[model samples]
Target: MSAMYGHRAKRFPKLPEHRRDQQIPDAFRTTMAGEYFMLGQSASRHILVLATSSNIRLMATRRTWALDGTFKIVPQWYQQLFTIHAFAAGKLLPLVYCLCTDKDIGTYGFKSQALIIRAAALEVDLNPDTNICDFETALIPAIQGYFPNARAVHRIAGELGLKTRYRQHEETRRKIRMLLATAFLPVPHVNTGVSLLEAGTTGTLAALFQYFRQEWMTDERLPLWNVHNIRTNNHLEGWHNRLNRKAGKSHNGLYELLQLLIAEQGVMDTLIQQVLSGNAAVGDLRRVNKVYAQKQRQVARYTGEYTNVRRTLKQFLEALIRVRAAMYGHRAKRFPRLSEHRHDLVLADQFKTTKSGEDFLLCQSNCRHILVFATGTNIRLLAACRTWGMDGTFKIVPQWYQQLFTIHAFVAGKLVPAVYCLCTGKDIGTYGYIFQALIDKAAVLEVDLNPDTIICDFETALIPAIRGYFPNTRVQGCYFHFCQAVHRKVGELGLKTRYRQHEETRRKIRMLLATAFLPVPHVNTGVSLLEAGTTGTLAALFQYFRQEWMTDERLPLWNVHSVNIRTNNHLEGWHNRLNRKAGKCHNGFYEQFHILIAEQGVMDTLIQQVLSGNVTVGDLRRVNRVYAQKQRRVAQYTGEYTNGRRTLEQFLAALMYLTPEPI
Candidate 1:
């Protein structure tokens, strides 16, 4: 009879017969004190704020707030168990419990019940200085609408975790990881780096670009991930995790959930006392404060490497972090996994478009090799040329390898980079791999790519491979590289800067080294002159030059009188342009890939322009216009009488007047 009497009598039906929003009667609205215990609510929505006491409301009014949710403690009918934690005295105290009907913008009672007005009644500021929350799509709109003036600090860890598992391929997957790694970087730098990373992504990987822009790259979301601030809602997350364990795994009823909150109120009161006494606090609050102090000092002491033309952003960051770590006698932390960085090498088939949407990545043939061309026509022009120029740049290659080498050839009289190769090392085997790939590619296209002459620096490892494969081809050395090598020997011999000042000795030493560029008969004559020359520094430099360059009649290999060009200036120019396009020496793989694709477009444009008769002799000649003009004039004088007809005075005064004015 007593148990039956405790149940409510249902003689009349309530407002909605099937309404899920069970009403809380006036009997449960207040505590022992006459002051209002539950926060104000309306019948239009199911809003019952638990533990909204004067003391808790007062503490919440003057402090920051973190709103979080847990599913484990929620009733079977409810969507989630929402908690609003007040950050006071460096601890997050659970001040309110909001049993939400559903996880949606409409389900929240902020608008329907006038949540801000009710909070104002308890002296609680609805809009605090900062409000930290998870990156929940539903929560974001509600918070933005309610707290327009408050700074929204969305936790970025959740987004970063989602991004780590974003793409399928390793290349794109790596880039997605880098997005989070770059969060600590300065804003402008992040903007630029993000754009570059975006350009490198395609196919399945490209989806992350939109994801980043939507979830993390928004203006409101950008500043939250700065290195100095709290980028994750660890405090709220930790509380939810503890609450979940406390409630156990099974779903509870509405009455049980309220009872759970009643128990939480006791714990909250205990935590409030601890916070006031400056005892134990949230782990995030303690650790972030402790680490930030040391981080600021370390960051200040270790002057970081600023990003520059020579150093890539990633390289600079790595060095900066390493320097900081070294100051503390620790290993540097590696941030951002190099993502789409290896796209060109690892996932070679994906990057297939250009800025103008052309077939930029010409071949996805082999993983061991990258045979890049500006266009299909570059192959044809390369095949037509009898001589090929080759050079490698160590600084401009991807960090994974030794050098970015290119094979150049004169196409329509303008020397252009024909084949770009990413070499693993500057060895005979590497060069053999490159040449064999080219030969195989040519066979597939039914085009003859065998060159009559191959010009390059004295890379011994490469020289043998070229000769062994293209046995009949003439191998020539660059005069500029040869001269640079001779100069290097002079430095090693300790001649000092004064070596060039001593004109007589300098000319004599040069004449001896110049023997390599002379005829077979004259080679011995020059060496003999050197042996008969004076016996000081000149003798030492000349003897070394002779033993190295003059031995075994090697003079014939460097004698440019037989080849069309002497210097590897075209090869050097190609490398310089490529380095600039790539933006750094040790560029990321994706960066190098983008550069290679762009280089293809540049070559194709030049080739098309030259073949169309748009490029004149003046354009082909990088020297002064007067030189090209003089060459053209000389061509017109093919039928001129004996050379004696043009006297020295006529050549000097008449030609000097024809020097074109500088534009």
Candidate 2:
């Protein structure tokens, strides 16, 4: 039966040998319902477009259109299989399919012209309000040339190639995301947003901005890519994926591909008929994801406010942070078995010691399970290091624990994880107990562990606990966390909108954060300068800052001027690495324990290599060029202030100028 079926399938006529010899057969020139399926071909016979009459008529009614080309599913003779989709009744329908031998401007121009002539013959107007596509130099101009009144909106397809670079550099990722957010800015403020982004970039980012300026900043193309109200071309790209799946393979013969397209059209026709008859609902084929819906709401709100002159470009950019936060802030659901696995005896024994049989489990209780994976070498390094970095990650913790807390020591010019603790809660009692465990273990090992400074985030309970356990140690807050706190306070005080629209307001708010860079003695003077002439939200902001950060004891914790390493970003990076290794949020207890044990072994080997001078660990934290430049400017300002060349107010103003807007 299989052999006979194969023989029957091969009985069809041979396909064309080349583009020049290609000809549509009479049987394939019309739809199954007898409407013209081969709508038109280019004069050079190099481009052929297929669309039934109903497809053209439906496309003419749509105000928005999307165009894209895919090469993977194209036959070997053609350059690509280009598609034009129409958004009708909330469904993105592929209305026209074109096969082209070239991807040049002439080829696209011919395709556009053919569509226009075909639509004219059917006495239907084919004018779209917006056209979405990738940043194809040839296709963009072709669309603009034929449809001068239509707005061209470019998709984010151009930036997909930079995904790896984005993952490696957080600052670069933030800047690139902000660039995409420029599309949501008001038409008049789009250039201003781009300019602000360009001013803060350097190195590779400078080259990226240069490309953006040259290709997308021109008068003719500026409006083409700014699509604040329109949807992206993701749905159109999805349709192409479906087509590839239906065809089963790439480079199908001419007849085979046509048959697939015809079948797709038949399905679409049935859907259209059902929708028109009220038997089916007419909307997006797939439900919008929650994150995407929230982002759309935010954009809509921001744009609505812009029209009323109540919102500014800076606010829109700030709102992008909220949008991004929404994407990553979702809490993972807990699994009952995963949480209970912490009490399993076999798993407990498995995780109680290092692979070499050293004591890795420091404490295991009903309320908490504190696992210290550091070997004795790590403990010695910890005792020798004066400045320790501490942080915690909640995403990858087992369901039974609240956070996977870590303590890192600066070893051989690199921050190395010295301890890992899985805590059941974030209260002061839990933190004090964990610190006590470390102290008692150090006593047993005869390693005196004393640190001059400990850098951590502003976790209220953890800070006091650290100070309580080590009376002489100074707990310095991360500078990044300090800025984040001030930004959050700005939102709390209802000053976010003002900060976004008013430059003076924004500068004053930034000056509050810049106080971190000032010497301890001069910080009060800087805050006094910012406090002058303040009323309303600004007054409240400075008041909150003074109470929370400028007290006699609290002042020293956040003042990072004399601190060489001002942020715990390295510790945060390590936690991220651990999260990736765990592979999923809220992993099984034994699985997380296994991952940590393996990491401890790796750390032991790394420590030995470092001590023997066989390996050197470079800075794990990525140095952001813009931030480094800002630091240099701060240093210059501080020196001038110390030399009496600038007044306190002058120094604060200069530092404020160097402060970056919260992303």
Candidate 3:
């Protein structure tokens, strides 16, 4: 009793004469003595058993120690302490200060405060500055100094390197501490003080993380410098918590925690392997199913139909019951029913057959129009190919295009988009009018554009009328028309040879421009190739080109101009996504098609940004710069120009002019 509070004031006294007549029974006292001795023996024996474990010994010797807290005394004890402290000190300290300084007081705060005020008050006041220094310099040590029993116990523990024993009922508390520490390794250890440890259970992992950075590791260099070292091996925690909570009445909680940790690790390893095998979504689904199975077994006692409340039990219990059912339940429902197939739909959707007869869902394709729809990030290609010829009835609607544009507002900090139209087998004029209606609707919606922007389409004669209405716009002939004109002008064989020559010229252009970054001497071979107008397919392709193509400043634009402006690959890609929903059975999209396409564009844009690494890709940064630069160089044409010089300030001004306003 004295050890509990550290002040030796009152002791139990002998009974008075009248009470002596009603003497205490020897049998009752003996029974009480035996029970108390047995309780003490059990506690000591349990501690000894922990000490005997090799794992415990090894952990104790290590410098690292995981700390946690458990409530020890009841609320009545709290009330008693408050009354006693108030009686001695005349009043409780201001509640705000009491709350604020409460954390600073560690274990045995009552004993420490009592001794400091009574026994050590004179020594402390004799030299206020020195005592304050002692108080501040070693607050934790001073608290321990006031209680001889606690100090002795802690000294023995520190000397022997004894790992503190956790309360039997508080294993969850200890595990939480260990899990948090492991997740944030190489970070300075968390305080593990009573308040912080208790806070971990209720707070989010992110909140605890911020707290660790701000409170525990107060060094200025903290968090920013040490962020990379923090390890988040939370897979075990996820599995353990699920399994522990799922443990049936038959199973011990401690054994379930350990067993589930082991099982969860195995399952995660398998799932990761499946993902690496190219079915990550499917693999995740499979793991989810397995967890459900385990939960079913754990909850088998409430065996009921899918429609029953038992079946509706949450995943934590459901997984345990399912696992047990799969393993040992004789009367439980067997394999998942056919209706379960709907649950697997999302996973099944992720799988596809490769061209080589392999079961791979994700494979790169050659057709750019269809390809961009799947991978999402092809705005530059979309814009360039808008003029290409598309034989199908698929079309681009203006209203939908504006909606798509609004969704993507920015791509890697640039504004680029594909044209939109309706598919029609009606004459070009009729199709053109349909596009006009969409444009009018877009205007009503107040869709913002460059005002100077020009949209060109297959309705060649209509371009001038559209441009007349929007004077800032200039309509360019579709590359699709130009490519078709070239074939009509030549023959099929000639068209094939011309295409091959075009590729060769592009390759030579790249080689010539390779060292241009350094401003070195030009290669004679490159110069010769540029000057010589040889009688081959390459020369024929460029034979009747505009004077703009001859200029140095416009040369880069020329390469893409033929592929995009001359052809309609850009518009065709949008048609393909819309057509995919309709398939060959339908000639054109119905009313729902417009909204679906618009919504799909939003999804694809987000996917593209993710793939391009404008945002961090799972902690990796700047992942797209090298790829973007390479693609830019490979896709463009280049030649030396006579008068293309502009100062950096002028360039910046021009860039600002070209940039889009924020939505």
What is candidate 3's CA lDDT for residue 565?
27
lDDT of 3 by residue, 630-657 (tens): 3343233222121235432222222222
Ranking by lDDT: 2, 1, 3
Per-residue lDDT of model 1, residues 148-261, tens digit only: 666657655554333434444565555665565566466667777677678856654567677777866777777665543344567777777667556643465456556566
Candidate 3 deviant stretches above 4 angstroms:
1-450, 454-462, 476-533, 536-571, 585-627, 631-663
Q: How close is candidate 1 to the true structure, as a TM-score?
A: 0.44
Q: Which stretches of candidate 2 lie over 4 Å from their true place?
A: 1-347, 355-357, 367-369, 612-632, 657-660
Off by over 4 Å in 1: 1-345, 348-350, 353-375, 609-663
lDDT for model 1, please: 0.60
Give per-residue CA lDDT, model 2, range 1-663, as digits (tens).
Answer: 122233435744565434566677887787677777897776465788998877877778779999998776776457889999987666788889998888888988888888888889889988998899988879888988999888888765465236556766777787788887887766788888889888967767788888888977788777777776774798887788667656655577667777777788877886655543556554435565777778778878877876787877677777776686776555322212232245552344657788878778776555455444556667777787898999889987865678888999876547888888888788898888878878887888898888999999988899999989988898898987788788889988898778866889988887787788788998898888788999988899999998888888788888878566888977887776676566556876666877888988878777666556676445334555555565576677778988999887777667665454443
- Tell me the lDDT of model 2 at 29: 82
Clashing pairs in 2: 152-224
Pick the lDDT winner. 2
The lDDT of each candidate is 0.60, 0.76, 0.29
Q: Worst lDDT window (10 residues) for model 3?
A: 91-100
